[model samples]
Target chain A: MGAAKVSADHPGIDELFALLAYGEVAAFYRLTEEARMAPDLNGRINMALMAAAEMGHFELVSDALEQRGMHVQQAMAKYRSVLESYHAQTIPSTWEEALVKTYIGDALAADFYLEIAEGLPDEIADVVRGVLAETGHSQFVVEEIRAAVAASDQQRSRLALWARRLLGEAITQAQYVMAERDELVDLVLSGTNGLGQLTEFFEKVQRTHADRMAELGLA
Target chain B: MGAAKVSADHPGIDELFALLAYGEVAAFYRLTEEARMAPDLNGRINMALMAAAEMGHFELVSDALEQRGMHVQQAMAKYRSVLESYHAQTIPSTWEEALVKTYIGDALAADFYLEIAEGLPDEIADVVRGVLAETGHSQFVVEEIRAAVAASDQQRSRLALWARRLLGEAITQAQYVMAERDELVDLVLSGTNGLGQLTEFFEKVQRTHADRMAELGLA
Candidate 1:
């Protein structure tokens, strides 16, 4: 497509990309800080590794924005409030909570990014695919969650409740974004049958969560 | 040299390496945890990056141990008490203390590692060089320290006092290790006239700290 057509088609792509970039940067910052909450040296190192990987994503998205003639700092500033509020409202309180946040939050982020990637141009899609392929952080989260669930019945119930709470908070914060950013909401809701696509998206996420919970013997 | 001859010549290399490996792991844990003391996201992320870089050192040392048919976990266990005690006693209470600990401690670590690397085998030296090459964390600490020192005269004096306290605690910890682990101390204190080399090492570190203080206009 021509430049004009591409710009018209993906009106809010820059904003969305910028928002995701800031999200990655914030994740890197928060995860690294939270890694200290680990009780053991090994756990701490592994969490740090996961946090560092988020920097790789941040650099990739930032570079993409630069390539598109957008200043990264300015773009990031636009969505800092939304991103910061999300983190502020969803701080993990325990190892289990942290793992649940990493697992559920990362999976949802990957799904959303993947959906957007499919709609973007080839170069942007390529960058997203590259990031999506590096699932080390999510894998660590999954293993930890499964291990925690398998260790004890009481722990499983507690963590399952925590996971549900994290999901709830995430949805609440996401709604804030949707309400405030009309262009972003419109872009996401476009090319779908009203709220049906969104409902299906939520259902798919719930199904995935159920599958994970069953795998961990929590469901 | 033959394996037996090499072991005999570098009798305490294993112990020293093991202690250093455990130190890196512990530092990674402590620094990652200490990142939370940061007053803002930027400071937290900077500390996190430093912690993450230490994990790279941990992996390198762990792999070096494994290559020698040694289990990293077993080696790490040998120095656990010493490493734990050092961190437990020196936990920073404020941002200034954290910055001093990161800046001065990391620089001292780099100097000590560089000194020790000179006497190690080629394979071990290469690992040390690789780990030392990433100085982003050190740069971040320097920038932060400089900014803090410039903020106010009182801030500079307070941070200088904190740095001295950290150094005193570190020396006490080092002496404890030296008294407890003669072999490791011997490895470090070897190749020079007994206490002279040890004294010179301390003096070198002191000079480096002075230089850093001068750079920050705090001296």
Candidate 2:
């Protein structure tokens, strides 16, 4: 509806949605692989459910792009490399690491999107909310992490370090995107407090990540 | 209702659900991997949707077992090897082969279940129907196959032969299951025509397979 504003100073909704759509697709693939590596049946099933939810989120963002008459493939193509690079750099070698990676990465991504959602039009923000709401696997991850750490104190420190590594990689990727796409940064910051919000957004994301780590007994 | 019938002369409903549950779990994993092999984003997304549906079916059958006081994991453990062997023997090397495997395998499995459903009690049969009804990804597969064939005749023959290989493997696995679980085979065949329906069931499965092959221009 407000195409002019979207084009001029706002974060390009198409670009942001495209980035998120591809991210979800990549996550779905990685999570499904992680599900296969799960040590037990229920763990496998839980991860599969999470992977399914990611696909659902991808569909949501893809549909949003389509409603705006953007080609799904073309919109998604540009953002593919950044997300794939992130996944490649942070490949989880174990089920525990996979859980931590999914938990921290997903939580951080959700927070960033929520921040961006605040600046978006009501309809687009609604789509963001729909994508953000599918946290069904969060509790499952928390349970698995705690149970894992409970079995060995070594696992606790190992996973805590892993979480830190994941957060580092995530922040690196986020900064890479922001550096590369000034439009996305503007879209993200313009609604709340402009450039000043960047510090506040990272702080908020860090707080949530720490809270999630605590929930997983890594705090 | 009819616990005696279930225990004495008939295949236990628990065994049936257990078999179906494991099969769905196995399919979810295989399909998820197949989704990754998809050459394009849309194909990947479509396969992920089908994989998700399989997970949903797994949950449905798992829940049914739980409601009957059966341990879901325990119930599923018995049927694991047969399904695993089927998947192990038929790993698809390419995206087209994956599609053919999924399309033909899913259709055959659905037909077999439908035939078996006729002998089940109403409630259990309803569960079977619910699982059988999730062919939502069928049209997506058909479109992809036709598009591939129209683009290259070489792809058509390669896929057609792959479909035949998949069918042979499926029959081999089905026979293995029948040989291993006489109760399951009995459960499968005892419904409609008592013990005389084996030939008729295979004929039905073959007919549907032909129709699907024709739809893909492989017949």
DockQ score of candidate 1? 0.33
Candidate 2 per-residue lDDT over residues B1-219, each given as its tens digit: 122122322545777788889998899889887776877877877888788788778778888788888899988989889899888998888888888888888888888887777777777888888876765777888888888888988999999888888778887887787788877876765565544567777777778888889998887
Alpha-carbon lDDT, every model: 0.70, 0.81
Scored against the native two-chain complex, candidate 2 gets a DockQ of 0.65
lDDT of each residue in A92-122, candidate 2, tens digit only: 8888999888888888888888877776667
Where model 2 places Cα greater than 4 Å from the true spot, the runs are A1-11, B1-11, B151-154
lDDT of model 1, residue A132: 58
- Residue A72 lDDT in candidate 1: 77
Model 1, position B213, has a per-residue lDDT of 70
Candidate 1 lDDT by residue in tens digits, B133-198? 664657667777788778888988988887777667777777787788877677666533357667
Residue pairs with backbone atoms closer than 3 Å in model 1 (clashes): none
